[model samples]
Target: KAAYNKYLSDKRAKSTRAYIISQGIDPKRIESAIGYGEERLLNGCDGSIKCTSAQHQLNRRSEFIIVDM
Candidate 1:
């Protein structure tokens, strides 16, 4: 299960890269996509929720940022 989740997360990051590149963002100008994988919770919840599916979905979500190179 962990392996599969990581796989999907990686795929999502790659898609984001493709998107930025297609939008005329230089591939080299773009930074790498990072997937923290449920390590940081928005609500400070340690993922104690008995149901893991929803938590997994949330963890797979991506975050982006722009900064001076």
Candidate 2:
């Protein structure tokens, strides 16, 4: 399960990066795209505990950080 989650996360990150580049953003302007996977759960829903579907959905998301240089 963990491996599958990581794989899905990786695909999501790469897809997001590709979409951004497709939008005319220079590839060089983006430093890197990474997926933390289950390692960075937003809430306490780490499989060991029961959580609502909405809570799990919250953890499945993408975040972008813009850096000013």
Candidate 3:
């Protein structure tokens, strides 16, 4: 499950990056796109804890960090 989750997150990140470029954003502007799957959980939803579907969904998200204006 861990490996699969990582793979899915990585794919999502790459797809998001592609989408940004498709929208006319310069690819060079993106230094790197990485997926830290399950590494950072928003609501502390882990394997040992019982989390609601909504909580799990929250962890499965994409976040963008603006490095420059």
lDDT of each: 0.67, 0.87, 0.88
TM-score of model 1 (CA atoms)? 0.65
- Summarize candidate 2's per-residue lDDT along 1-69 as a digit string, tens digits: 888888888888889999999999999988887777799998988799999999988888878778975
Model 3 per-residue lDDT tens digits across residues 1-69: 888888998998899999999999999999878887889878788777998899889988788889889
Candidates sorted by TM-score, descending order?
3, 2, 1
Across 1-69, the per-residue lDDT of candidate 1 in tens digits comes to: 545655767788888889888999988787797554445556433446564666555655677777885
Q: How much is the lDDT of residue 11 in candidate 2?
A: 86
Colliding pairs, model 1 = none
Model 1 stretches with alpha carbons more than 4 Å out? 36-48, 52-56
Pairs that collide, model 3: none
TM-scores of all models?
0.65, 0.90, 0.91
Native-to-model Cα distance after best TM-score fit, residue 64 in candidate 3, in Å? 1.0
Which predicted model would earn the best lDDT? 3
Candidate 3, superposed: residue stretches over 4 Å from native = none
TM-score of model 3 (CA atoms): 0.91
Let me know the TM-score candidate 2 reaches against the reference structure. Answer: 0.90
